[model samples]
Target: MPHNPISNVQHDVMHSLYMNHHNWLYTWIRRRLDNQFDAADLTQDTFLRIHAKQNVDLINEPKAYLATIAKGLVSHFYRRKSLEQTYLEYLAKQPENLAPSTENQFIILQTLEAIDALLNTLPGHVKEVFLMSQLEGKKYQQIADEMTLSLATVKRYMKQAYVHCFVLMENDFFE
Candidate 1:
């Protein structure tokens, strides 16, 4: 096998970390999720994400680092499931002919996840106005009344949301 000194060292460190703590991390996640299958998957994801960072040697507290990564993965797992369920519910209510193909569901879920991540970066009121207008089909005046804000403020929030989305799209960062 071809050897790159940096990658070889990283692999060894990652392997050592995994061998030492996989069981503990898996058990911790399993208890939280109450499912061995998901726990195992997330445990693997946590390690893979860490491995991908190529900085295994820099960690001083290996277990602590692994635990932090594992916890974040578990949270992401739940968030993804919630997003999928919400998308499914929305699709279920759509007219039969308007439903996307089964193959498109995965892509749509990924897109929604990306969009949700993007929205999470916005201020609370900005995100609220964007979702109310785009998802709930609310008028700006309605959002203003519900949010107890002036109509101009609501419009500005919507404008900010749209501009942010447009910039991300322009850079192909959202794709």
Candidate 2:
């Protein structure tokens, strides 16, 4: 079967992209991380993501493409770190006998991370309302009163949030 240049030369294109952009990407992430070791690791991770995602068979703006992917990796790294710290603080607050065992703690932490990732994509107000109602166990009226939003507005926000989450589930965001 014959294919166009785009499909035929994908490997060459990817190699060229890697050669041209990998060093710059590494330096960029390194500067942000302020630690050479972590920077190197994340740089490799960035490329791995591109390869796995197959987003680099064509490179129009190599630097911009690499930077965007690397930036996402950096953001995820920070988000995961914050989730870890929050989880540790939660464990600390629990009485010693009541806290989960070490293995269970890891499971709970991963669960929290998955939930956080799901919520992170929602709009600010939608996310706030969702969290207040779900995590804080607040009533819709209480949420409306606390945020100075009308009851109707609160209902709309909750509906929007729930719909967004349902869509994500349908689209396999959980996977």
Instruction: Report the C-alpha lDDT of model 2 over 11-88, residue by residue, as the tens digit.
Output: 676777778887888899989989898888899887877777665665577788778888988988888888899889
In Å, residue 153's CA in model 2 sits off its true spot by 1.2
Candidate 1: where is the Cα deviation over 4 Å? 95-98
Best by TM-score: 1
The reply for model 2, stretches above 4 Å from the true place, is 1-8, 55-57, 170-172
The candidate that wins on lDDT is: 1
**CA lDDT of each prediction against the hidden true structure:** 0.91, 0.86
TM-score of each: 0.89, 0.82
Residue pairs with colliding backbones in model 2 are: none
Candidate 1 per-residue C-alpha lDDT over 4-31 given as tens digits, one digit per residue, 9 for 90 to 100: 9988899889889999999999999999
Alpha-carbon RMSD to native, per candidate: 1.9, 3.2
